[model samples]
Target: MADKSSSNAYWKANIRMIQLFLVIWFVVSFGFGIILRPMLSGIAVGGTDLGFWFAQQGSILVFLVLIFVYAWRMNRLDKEHGVEE
Candidate 1:
């Protein structure tokens, strides 16, 4: 039915968005903070190396921003799919 297809589409889009955000978070928190720390050591932020900054603070800030961004985006997505509250 049309409703079922629409629901599937909505879920697909939502999952895609979540995957994208998760990749971003992983790259920031794990890649930069650990795996790529040596490469980023030359860069300074808030009196520490970029990697440390990401490990200690930058990733958290990015995650908080992502939370707000995800909420706003989901609201828009819901409205687009006629599922808004």
Candidate 2:
């Protein structure tokens, strides 16, 4: 495309998406897995401590969703901005 603003729009959108996802990822893994885990120790998941579940399983699930969300959003944004190529 000859439009520079359109290219910038794509970068900005992707940047925001990546930043938000990383923050969420950090909060779930480091925060729930280690830092704030004690506060959640009383909770259980599949008969295990919630923090342990987060460390072992929940983070993986979140990462899956994050990847799918990024793909879907990128596809939509690409079409919206005529940058699918």
TM-score of 2: 0.90
lDDT of each: 0.92, 0.91
- Candidate 1, residue 79: the lDDT equals 89
> Model 2: clashing residue pairs?
none
After superposition, candidate 2 runs with Cα above 4 Å error: none
| lDDT score for candidate 1 against the true structure | 0.92
- What are the per-residue Cα lDDT tens digits for candidate 2 across 29-82? 999988999999899788888899989989899989999998999899989888
- Model 1 residue runs over 4 Å out of place are none
Clashes by residue pair, model 1 = none
RMSD of each: 1.6, 1.3
On lDDT, the candidate that comes out on top is 1
**TM per candidate:** 0.91, 0.90
Q: For candidate 1, write residues 1-85 as lDDT tens digits.
A: 4487777899999999999999999999999999999999999887889999989888999999999999999999988888776
Give candidate 2's total backbone clashes: 0
**Cα deviation in Å at residue 67, candidate 2?**
0.4
